[model samples]
Target: MRLAIVLYPGFADWECALLMAAARTHLGVEIDVATADGATVTSMGGLDVSPHLSIDALDPAGFDGLVICGGTVWDTAEAPDLSGTIRTFDRDKRLVAAICGGVNALATCGLLDRVEHTGNNAASLAALHGYRGQTHYREQPQALRSGHVITAAGTAPISFAGEILRGLGLGSEELDGFLALYGREHVAATSAG
Candidate 1:
């Protein structure tokens, strides 16, 4: 299946690295990167990446799902209005995944209002101010999924990836195997320490 990943300047690198790698290796999913302008965008860690398409140019129907990577910009005035694209994915019944500050896009678009979700924190998400979906927020430890939306805190990329794989219909055994290969210890350690 083909998936579209949205990246902005300062997008989080860790959020999708393992997911992208494991999904490619184990699930053979095809991925394309998109940005507001189809220009080269840099991650928060200073890695440069060129987007495969611009948001306006990407056809929602061409992708099986959409994944949004978080960055500080999601919380800023510079954030792009992704509501239309996100809504299209929702209408099409495709998976919509967001983590950390990327959750802001979902929140801003009114998608989080109906589905249970978690983010960097309640406050960061609450700070979205005009969003009327606060009551739908759940105070989970990390990842949360409701309907077609998958959300996680910035620090929970592994769990985030797990939730996304689960949404992709990967069997529990396959998820367990994939996690054992790359997640078990890290998840345990992160939880413990």
Candidate 2:
């Protein structure tokens, strides 16, 4: 699968990393990390990641899926009209996944209407109210799969990645392999408690 991960100036590094690791270790998929521009992108935590393509340079038809990374940037700065790009991909029936505040970006693009979604904060949840879709909030990291739109609550990277894998026609067993490769045993144990 050819996956495109949206990167902004202040995205979360761990979010991108986990998804990339899952794509690489589990699905054995070719992943491309892209930014609004071809420039290097930084995370909210000050980590920098280089991009494989810029939004302007990417051909939406070439990607199998697009994963938008969310953080403080989604709330403050204006993101590229990713909704249009996502809509184009959706028209072709490609998979689109958003995490945390990235859902806000998708909402702005009119993609969340009539789709079930969850976000990181109360503000994001409130934003979803104006959307045409069923909005839900839960404590557990749950992946709500509604057709082509795949969403997850905040900090649910494992579940989020699992959802993406499943959407790509992979299995939960692949997600487990990714977790093991990433040395997420401690996190799994802690969360399981």
Candidate 3:
């Protein structure tokens, strides 16, 4: 499976690093970086990435999903309105995932209005003009997948990754174990033979 990770200036790079590593290492998912203008974007951590694919250039047919990394730009007044690209992916039945401030984009696009989604909190979303999905908002520390959309708080990348895998039909016992190891203090269950 192939996934496109959308990045922006001042993005939270660490949020998706473990997810990308684990998914690619375990599931063999091909992950690519995409930016707003097919140029380089610097993360909040000062990591620079030069992406070849522009957000407008992504073809939903060619990629299985779009994972948007949270960035401060998303919370600014001049946030990128990703409605068109996001809707295109959703229209084609492809996975649409976002976390932290990235969730604001989904809120701006009104996808969260139709599905149960979680982010940093519901109060923050209420500030957005396009957000009318308050009733559908779920307050949780983990990532949630409703229909084909996945949303998460910034602190829940491990959970977000697991949900992404689950959304991609890659959920399994091993996957659970994989996430458990990363998410918490895992306790292994033993079977009596």
TM-scores, one per candidate: 0.91, 0.82, 0.93
User: Mind giving the per-residue lDDT tens digits that candidate 1 earns over 1-193?
Assistant: 8888899999989998988888888789888999898999989899999888998876767987799999879877888889999999999999999988889989988898888888888887777855667788888766898878999998888888888888888648868776767655554444555
Q: How far is each candidate from the true structure, as Cα RMSD in Å?
A: 3.0, 3.7, 4.1
Please tell me which predicted candidate would have the highest TM-score against the true structure.
3
Output the better candidate (1/3) by TM-score.
3
Clashes of each: 0, 2, 0
Q: Model 3: which residue pairs collide?
A: none
State the lDDT at 144 in candidate 2: 67
**Colliding pairs, model 1:** none
Whole-model lDDT values for every prediction: 0.85, 0.74, 0.91
lDDT (0-100) at residue 3 of candidate 2?
A: 93
Which of the two, 1 or 2, has more lDDT? 1
Q: Estimate candidate 1's alpha-carbon lDDT, on a 0 to 1 scale.
A: 0.85
